[model samples]
Target: MSIEVGSKLQGKVTGITKFGAFVELPGGSTGLVHISEVADNYVKDINEYLTVGDQVTVKVINVEKDGKIGLSIKKAKDNPKPSSNRRKSNTHSKGNQDRTETFEAKMNRFLKDSEDRLATLRKHTESKRGGRGAKKG
Candidate 1:
């Protein structure tokens, strides 16, 4: 059976490498599952996720002109659950601070900060030069 992009198929892991896993598709054709496409989280080791001869459902990501296929095991799975421990906090309380600043005020603040930084850099360079003028030979 020929595989097309976006097609999902059941395959068996034929080989595993540090970079990826090789899967044997239905028609005896083999495809590569890149390390990054293995899962939603960071995969430091491919062995942590798969092994040779393991059955997996993969999605066809690409089909090269040379008949090479690229697959994704991550996309074939459903959406992953979000970590409950990582909740966002609103630091700016509703009544504690102004909700918005005027465009002019924002621009003025940015310009002031930039000028201060430039002044500090200029002072640093001048100090490095020992406040000495160029010698007139």
Candidate 2:
């Protein structure tokens, strides 16, 4: 089968590297599945997810003019299916929700947090400076 952009196919993992996995498509063509395209979550190590001789379904993201095929396994499995009950609602209503905060309350909270952080940073800097000053004394 000819590989085209957006074409989904099953391929075998021929090799694995730090950057990506080499997959051999049906038409004796090889494609590279980048590390980001291996899974939905962050893949620290590609070997942890796939190894040589593992068969997986991948989508052809790009078939360059120079015959370079870019494959993706994450994009192919990103959207499984949408449920009818999970559809977004259009109704809008205003209920008893506290959206107002007094100026004094806001300032007090902000000042308290800022002061705590500043105190911690000052203590750290002073300790470093004090150590140097003691050596001179």
Winning candidate number (TM-score): 2
Q: Give the residue spans of candidate 2 off by over 4 A.
A: 78-126, 131-137
* lDDT of candidate 2 over 75-121, digit per residue (tens): 77758432322222211122432346577876886899999999999
Off by over 4 Å in 1: 80-137
- Worst 10-residue lDDT window for candidate 2 reads 84-93
Candidate 1 lDDT over 17-129, as tens digits, reads 98999999998999999999998777999999999999999999999999899999988986743332111112143234333567787688689999999999988887788
Cα TM-score of candidate 2: 0.64
TM-score of 1: 0.60
**CA-lDDT, candidates in order:** 0.84, 0.83
Residue pairs clashing in model 2 are: none
Report how far residue 74 has shifted in candidate 1, in Å.
0.3
Per-candidate TM-scores read 0.60, 0.64
Q: What overall lDDT, based on C-alpha atoms, would model 1 receive against the true structure?
A: 0.84
